[model samples]
Each structure stands twice: as structure tokens, then as C-alpha cells.
Target: MNNNLQLYNTLSRSKEKFEPLNPPNVGMYVCGPTVYGDAHLGHARPAITFDIVFRYLMHLDYKVRYVRNITDVGHLENDADEGEDKIAKKARLEELEPMEVVKHFTDRYHKNMDQLNVLHPSIEPTASGHIIEQIELIKSILDNGYAYESEGSVYFDVKKYSNDYDYGKLSGRKLDDLLENTRTLTGQQEKKNSYDFALWKKTDPKHLMHWPSPWSEGYPGWHLECSAMGAKYLGETFDIHGGGMDLLFPHHESEIAQSNACRGHDPVHYWMHNNMITIDGQKMGKSLNNFITLDEFFSGKHKALDKAYSPMTIRFFILQAHYRSTVDFSNEALHAAEKGMQKLFNTVELIDKLTPSSNSSVDVQHFKDSLYAAMDDDFNTPIAIAQLFELSKIVNQVNDGKETLTASDILFIQNLYSVFVFEILGLISENIKGNDDQLVDQLMGAILSLRQDAKQNKDWATADKIRDELGKINIKVKDTKEGAVWNIE
Candidate 1:
């Protein structure tokens, strides 16, 4: 289980060699959705990005406990301390209970993730479910003299914490700059400093979500839930903490302050953040009103989409770019990704049918080495995918009888595709459903056999009719020396 993985640490602002706190056992925590609305393309980016991280760590023979939390209770509208709770607002708009709203959106999120082929996390804690832990954490911060209670609300004292620690070390923000730039929003007057953020807020009488605490009958702050839930599951310290780059500011920065203020040290060893998705060179977000939900992309119901994109096509499109790079979505790019995904799937099928010879022509070992090397370099999926494309070319040549492969080489190719494509990259054939694949194959085989019989009997009209009908259904049939091979176009 030799693994030399390098990952970019947003904390240190550089790529560093990955060293887990405990060898063979790693813990990772990622910030999850608030469950107030359907997941969009922006949401898919970090989900798939950290999913690769989780899959690759397991591939390296590490026992990983991955925790991604649901922000069901504390998240507020506009990410402000005084705004309406996002889930509560949505519940009001939909005329449902807050819990009902949470359950509905959470289920939809899971379904979208399932369609995208993302594995479920080892633990999915919800903010509402962990109120006691969050209250305890806030108490600890107050005990440590880094937080204060004012008018039944508790706020983390950014100025007091900064005097004893580098408050903005993770985000490279200075205390003075934060104070100067902090917005003077309504209900912030109670804080000792403008830069101070809430750990727990005293709820309004009409507030839907409230928990009993010594300081107030209110919900935990947005940032406190992750800090409490992560430390509760992964301990006071852990290996990796990942989320979207947009969270690097107040959300994650405040997490750093709250955790360190309680534990007297950083909670995570490595900090990873996936970049945002862009549309027409601008960030696509709900606030921007240009955001497209995952369902909308799948259904092609949005004006921006030219056609419905398969889940695998959306997954491939995201992986085609490096995780840290801004991925711009477009119809042309998605079409190319759909075509490329089909080519890879077709090559894998072709590889299984290629007969082995006494010798090999391609450097299978070199290809394997390059593929792993690309993955090792900060999970450079785009580079690894490029090498897979190269291997696909070799597989195609062998299938065309233009090249030869030994039995061992053929096995190597199959295993490599299984590991890199199916296991690590988490790509599944969109056209092939479980059990349906075998049935489809059996049906296609029967149809193709009927066509072969017609051709053998020189019944040209019947054979032509069968071929034309399959073509109309986007199934291409190719005639070869071995007979006719059918594939979905």
C-alpha cells in the first residue's frame, strides 16, 4: 500500500505531500448542502471533487471515515446572522413544515447524487440533530475567553482571538482589514467588534427552529454546526477538511476561529477547496438568478441547455477539468463530453472482445505508471483521463486487428480500466442499467442474429429493414468479419 499523494492545502497555500495523522486510518469532513433547495451544477462540483478524494484514499488501502454534514437548521438567508433561516423561509413559501422541507430537499439531493454516481459518505450528520454538541462547543469557546454572550446571543470575539492567534491565517485576511470591510448589517450592534461572528443566536419569537441553550433559545450558528459535528465524529483533530472555494471566506474562516478557540489548535491537517462553476464567465449561484439545478440540466428544461445531458456526461464534463480550476458550462462542451464518454465506453467493450496473440505491441506498464502518476499529482483527473484516452486508442487499434496483445497485456488493460475508470473516476455506463444491460444484450443478440440469417438467405429487404429500424433508435450496427456488432450511438 505505497501511496505518495500530493494535494493542494488551501491553509498553507501550496501543494504538499499528504500524511495522515494515523497511518492506514484517515478521516475527512466536507461541508454539505443546507437542504433548502434542489442541488445545482455548482453543488455537484465539490461533491464530485471530494468524492474522488474519498475513492482514491480507499484505493490506497486507507480506512477512511468520510463525514459530510447537512445544514438543516442554522443556515440563514444571505449568510447573515439576523436574516431568516433559509429552510424556514422555504417552508413558509411552500406551506410545509420546516422538517418537511428539509426531508424533501435532502431526498432530492441524494437522488441527484445517486444519478451522478457519487458514493454516500460514511456519516451524514445534520445540524438540527447535533444541537447539544454545538451548544457544548459554544460553551467551550466562552470558557476559553474567545467568545462572549450579549443579550442572550453568543458571538465569537474575533478581536480577542486575534490578539492571541493569527485569526485570518487560513484565508490570509487581516483582522484590521476584516473590521474595515465588515458590513454593518442590521442586528450586529451587540457584537464588541464588527468582525465578530455568531456562535449561537437568540431566536425571534416567530423563529421556527430553536434549541434550548444556557445563553438563548435559538439555533446554532451556521459555522458552528460543522465545527461541532466534525469534532464530534473525527475527534478534536482530523486529516482532511474540504468544501467549495466560496466557503473559504467567512464560513470556513469562522470555523477555523471557533475550532481553534475551543481546542487551542487547528482542527484539520489538510484543507482542500474545489473551485466554483461558471456560466458565461460569471459564477452560477442561486443569488445570481442564473443558476441551473441538476434536475434542470438532466431534463433540459432550462433555456441555457440545448438538450438533456445524461448524468455520466455531466460527471465526465466536470472531471475533464482539474478540480481546482473553474469549469465553464456550455452546450458545446457537454456535447463533446458526451461523445468522449461514449468513445471510452465503446473502447472498453471492444477491449473485452479483442483476441489475445502471442505478443504485445503497446507499453501497458508505461501507461499504467503514467495514469497513477497523474492521479498522485494532486488528483490531476484531467491528465489521468487524457492517458485513458490514449489507452482507448490502443484498445481500438487492437480491436481493429492493427495491433497485437498477449494474454497478460489484455488482462492488464482490463484491470486498469476497472480500477481507474469504474473505481477511482466513478464513471458508470449511462445507457446500461443493472440487469437491464443483460436483457438488452440478449435482445440485441437475437435481433442481430435474425438479421444475419436474413443476409445469409439473401433476403436483402428484410436485412435492410432491420438495420434501418435499429439506426432510427440511435443504435449503430457495424458489419465485420466476426458478424454484426451493435452499439448505442
Candidate 2:
């Protein structure tokens, strides 16, 4: 196995060679969804990004225990710790139990991930289920004198924690700047500083979600869940902590403070963050009222979609860009990705039919080296994909009798695609839109057979009508020497 993988660390702001804290055994924790709404394109980015990390790490012969948390409780409406809990609000509006809402959306989230071919994490712990763990974590922070109880609510003392340790080192923020720019919101008089975040909130009688803690009959704060659950599953110091770059602020920043105050050191060795997906140069999020859910993209229900995009096309579109770079959503980009993905798969299918010669014209060893080299350099998938396209050209040449490949070289290319495209990239052949679907292919074959019969019988009207009617529904039919072919336009 080639073990020269390097990944970008958000803490140090550099691409560092990945060396696991414990050899052959790696622990990774990622912050999962809040589960109040549908899984959108924005959510897909981190899930697919960390999934590639998870897949590639295991491919290198490492035992990885990946834990992704489900935030079923304690996430409030704002980062300022004001307003009602997000899940509770959803439950109240729908006239359903809080857990009911959590279960419904969580199931949908799992379905979306399955369609995208993302693997489930080894341990998926939920915040509501781990109340005892979160409470115990708060007790440790309080005992360390970094938190204080105020009117039945416990808030982390950011100003006090700043005195002993750097409060904003992970986010590169200063306490002075935070204090100066902080707004004094309503119901914040209980805290010593406006920047101080809630560890445990004293829920009102009307609040939907509440638990009994030593400080108050309330729930844990939004940021406390990951710190508690991560330590429980992956130990106090884990190998990697992954999430979106949008969490680099108060959420992840507070996690650093809580871990340092309690355990007296950092909890994670490497902090990884994936960039956001955007629309019209703006971040596509539910808060912005601009996010297109995965269902909308798959079903073509959104006003922004030109046509329904398959799960594989969405995956390919995302992989075409580096995880650290912004991917802007556009119809043209998606259409091109769909075509490109089809071409790659078509070339792979053609490789199996090539006649092997005595000697190879293509440099198969150099091509294999290029594939590993792209993945080694921070998992640069776009570069790896480009290399595959170059090989696709070679595959086409071999099929066209312009280039030659020995039997061993043909086997090597087939294995390369199997590992890189199917295993590491997590693309499913059955989900690749058109020709890969057996049912659709069978139906199109029957329809084209009827059209060809009409043409052969000298019935010009029937043949032209069959072709014209299919075009009305965005399915184009073409006449070639091999008879008739139809495709989704």
C-alpha cells in the first residue's frame, strides 16, 4: 500500500503529511446534521468529502473508527444562544413529538446519503441520547473553574478561559475584537460577557426540549454535544476531527475551549474542514432560503434545476473540484458533469472488449503512478479524475486499433478503475443515469426496435411520428448505421 497521503489541517493552515496518532488504528469524529430539515446540496459536500477520507484511509490498511454525531437537541435558532431549540421549533409547528421530527428527517438524511453512496460512520451517537455524558462533561468544566452557574443556567466563561488559555486560537479570533463587535441581545443580562456561550441553558416551561442537569432543568448547549460524544467514542485525543468550514467560528472554536478547560489540552490532532457549495456566488444554506435539497435536485422539483440530476452526477460534479475549493451550482456545470461521467464509464466498459496485443503502446506504469500521486497530494480528486480522462483517451485509442495494450496492461487498467472510481470515489454503476439502468435500457431498446421496424416497413409517417413524439418529452432519437438510438436530452 502507498502511504504517502497528505491532508490540509485547518488549525495549522497547512497541508501536513498524515501520520496517525496511533499506528494502524485511527479515530475520526465529524459533526453531523441538526436533522430539522431536508438534506440539501450543502450537506452533501461534507458527507461526501469525509466519506472519501474514510474510504481512502481504510484503503491504506488502517483501522478507522469514524464517529459522526446526530444533533437531535440543544441546537438553538441562533449562535448567540437565544431563541428556541431548532428541532423543538420544528416539532411544535408540525404538531408532532420532538423525537418524531428527529426520526423523520434523520431517516431522510440516511436515504440521501445512501443514494450518494456515502458509507455510514462506525458510531453515530445522538445528543439527546447522551444527556448523561454531556452533563458529566459540564461538571468537569465547572470543576476546572472555567464555567459558572447563573440563575439556573451554566455558561462557559470565555473571558476567564481566555485569561488561562487562548480562547480563539483555532479560529484566529481575538477576545478583544469579539468583545468589541459583540451585540448585546435580549435576555443576555445573566452572563458576565455577551461573548460567553451556553454550556447548559435553563429551559423555560414552554420550551419543548428540557432535561434535568445540576445547574438547571434544561438541555445542553449546541456546542457541548460534539465535545462530550467525541471524547466518549474516540477518546480525549483523537486522530482527526472533520466538518465544514462554516463551523470554524463559534461552534468549533467553543469545542476547543471546552476540551482545553476540562482535559487541559486539545482534543483532536488534525482538524479538517471542507469548503461550502454556493449558488449565485452565495453560500447555499437553509438560513439563506437558497438551499436546494437533495430530493429537489434528484427529482427536478426546484425552479433552479434544468432537469433531474442522478445521484452519481451530483457526486461526480462535486468530485470534479477539490474539497477545499468552492463549487458553484449551475445547470451547465451539472450537465457537463453528467456527460463527463458517462464518458468515463463508457470507456471503462470498452476496456473489457479490447483485444490484447503482444506488447503495450501506452505507459501503464506511469499512468498508475499518476493516479497514486494525485491522491497522495492532499487527495486531489480533480487531478486524479483528469488523469483518468487521459487514460480514457488511451482506452479509446486501443479500441480504435490506434494503440495497443497487452493482456496484463488491460487487467491493470480494469483494477485501477475498480479501486479508484468504485471503491475510493464511492460511485455506483447502477446510479449513473442513462445506459447503466437496466430497466431504462430495456425500455429504450424496445421503443427503438419498434421505431426501426416502422422505418424498415417503408411507413415514413409512423417512423417520423415515433421519433417526433419522443423528442417532445426531451428524449432524442437518432438514426445511425447500427439502426436507432435514443437518449435523454
Candidate 3:
């Protein structure tokens, strides 16, 4: 509901103040994983990017209904209209049901998102579950003379639709250039033009997934699902549509065309896209055989990674850069992020223990305003994070007795960190835990007390056995003048 909030709209190619169609109500649709394989670094960027948008809008008191669709079907192997469906191909290769493949990968995808602290969408509709809706959308397009059926398949009249409406406004592609450069591929003979895309594709004998449709026994096209599901869940037009920049060309552009063809108008008010995560100056993707999966990063199982990085580190690394900027992956960058995250957490802890004074040494309102200004200007998380770092320096000064804060200022600082760091940025402290870790620490203290008793009684054998047993499990016990302390090695 904040009128000052601005977002970079890919359609307009500029930052614009976000105004929802309805007051205090926002509808956002983001393109989600295809679930044909393990989620990779490429998948994490957009998820985290939109998670920021989702969190900030809700923080602004907007009743946000975020719809992120799961593409369980109709996403082809080559991202084209003719190739095998990605999930179906995985199923065929693994000798399992297509839905089973979808469930397996989708579960892993969800687990990874949860580890990254990404919030779940309000509604997650699947393409397979919404087959009927896609069929009806195709029917509407055909009725409106924007699509045609050929040899039991339906193709969107892209060349024809371009004449009536702007075809590539989202992607900025020209129809004549597309037609001239678009190479002829297999299974395109039925189309009137080479650039025309499918609304529905006729299933071949070997095609593993299909449903009965009016045109033929087929499945929805790759671009048809988002158009159908976005309109179904968020009305004919919604506030924001988001995805990775790589999808801007064919996937999202076709989505715009499909929506316009059927609904006779634009579907989304704002189009937003997050840039890619690159490795060795190349975009990370599964097809390139150079991408690393989230599992590999967490476990340090990939050859490219120097060591294991926590989920928060990965999330921090992505957020350290603007959502629209390409983030190149490197171990040094991740290590820096890990250190930066720990410093922020340490500052929060220090702020909690700070004693208040009768007078404040700093203007806490300036800090708040700076943070808000960064977010309002296109969700600039890096700048907001910089402000947090500056606040960390101030907190260090107060803790060291070089500065002071009033009781009200201290309370304000606490609430500010809680709202921005935990709620909006979705960062959780790795070293800090809830009651579970407290209980573990207490139990460990009792065990250490028993070892101390053994040492006091001069039972060298028992003390050595206890210490050795603990060592076998990767716990190192250090004895100093203060006392014996144990840590996980």
C-alpha cells in the first residue's frame, strides 16, 4: 500500500511506482520450476528475488495473493512446442509415471526453497491439474480468430496476432526479425508461419503424457500454462508477473501473446524479471553441463566448490547484488557473504545487550529512512544491507562505550532489525537457535560436569575415556584455567 514503492517493470523497461488494481490487494504471479530435475543455482535466484517482493509487499500491509505455478507438464525438453515434455521424458527414462517424477522433483524443490527461507505461494497450481483451463483458453483464442487448428493441433497465429496487437512488447522482439532468423525445426509443417507457436500440441504414439482435447489427444503448450493459470487464479489481469530474465524472450513473450489473444488485452500490469547467475562468465543451466545443484552447494559435493556453504550464505550471496544484475558465482564471494552474515548476526546480538542512556548519540530515524528509501527504489537490497552494515558499526561503538542510545532509540533499533533482517530479508542466524539448542547446551553442560567430577576424584582412566569417546564423535574438549569447554570440531 506504500505509494512510494517502485519496481522495475520489464514491459516498460523502467522503474515505475507500483499501484495495485485494488487498494490493499495485490496479485503476483511468478514462473516456477519445471520439476524435471534437481533445482540448481539458476533456480534459486528468481525464487529469492520474488520472495523479497512477496515479503516487502506484505510488509507494506498489502493483502498479497501470490500465485507461483508448478509446471509439471507441457514444458518440453527443448523448451519448444514439438519436443517431448520434460517431465514425461524424465519419467520415460527412469521407468516411472510422469506424475511420480513430478512429485519427486517437486518435493526436492520445496525442501530447497524451505532451506533458503523462501515463502510458499498462496496458490501453486500445476499445468496438468489445470488442463481444462488451458483448453478453454485455446478455444477462446480460436474463437477470437487469433489461433487456428491444423492436423488435430492448435497453433497461435503469431504473425496474424502481431498485425492486430504488439506481439513482443515484453521481450522487445520484432516479428519480421523473428521470422527471418527463426530456423525451421521439426514438426512445424502445419503452422502458417515459422514463428507461430503452439497453443496445444498433438501427442505422438510415444508421448508419455496427454489428455483428451477437442483438437486432439494432446497437452497444453509450454507458454499456454502460465497464461491460463495466471488468469484463472488472479483474474484476467493481475498486478505483477515475474520470472528469470532468460525466460523473457520466448516463454514470457508468448505468455503475453496468449493472454492478449484470448482476453483481448494485456494480462499483467507489471512485468518483472531477475537476472541470471553465471559461472565462468556463462549462464548456469542444466543443458550446459556446467551448473551446480543446490544439494551440491549445501554438501560441498561439487568439484567447483571449495567448501560447503550454508543455505543462508547462498541466499545472502544472491541478495548482495541487485535482483536485475547478473551475479557471478565464486567461492570467494560466498565466503565473504558468510562472514558478512555472521557480522550482522553478531551486531544484532550486541544490540540486544546494549544499555540505554538518557540521550541518544545517533539519529535512528535516519537509519530507518535510508533503509526504506533503498527498498522503495526497486527493492535495492544491497543498499539496504549496506545501511545495516553502517548500523552494525554504530552498534559496535555503543557496545564499546564510545556511543550511547536512549531507551526509545534502543527499542526502535531492535524492532528495525527484526522487521528488515528477519521478516523482509528472510535471514535466520545460523549460530543462534531456539529452545532446542538451549536444551542441548544444558545437557552438554551436565555431561561436562560429570567429566569434571571424574577429574576432581583423580580418576584419570575415566576422564581420559570420556574425553576420548567425545573425540571419536568429532567433539574437542579444551581444558584451560577458566574450565573445560567442549565444541563441535
Candidate 2 residue runs with Cα over 4 Å from true position: 79-82, 431-489
Per-residue CA lDDT of model 3 for 1-489, tens digit only, reads: 446899999998999999999978999999999888999999999999999999999999999999999988845566544567777777878999999999999999999999999999999999899999999999999999999999988999998898899998988898889888876576679999998888888998778899999989988888988998999989999999999999998999999899888878999999999999999989999878789999999999999999998999999999999999999999999999998998898788778788899998888779999999999999999999999999989888888889999888888989999999999999998763333688768877888899999999999899888889989986778785558876663
Alpha-carbon error at 53 in model 1, in Å? 0.5
Global lDDT scores for all candidate models: 0.90, 0.90, 0.90
**What is the clash count of model 2?**
0
Off by over 4 Å in 1: 79-82, 433-446, 449-464
Estimate the TM-score of every prediction: 0.95, 0.92, 0.91
The ten-residue window of minimal lDDT in model 1 covers 430-439
Q: CA lDDT of 25 in candidate 1?
A: 94
What tens digits encode model 2's per-residue C-alpha lDDT throughout 78-119? 653556778888798899999999999999999999999999
Question: How high a TM-score does candidate 2 get?
Answer: 0.92
Cα lDDT, model 3, residue 222:
81
RMSD versus native structure for model 1: 2.1
Residue-level lDDT tens digits of model 1 in 7-50: 99999899999999988899999999978889999999999999
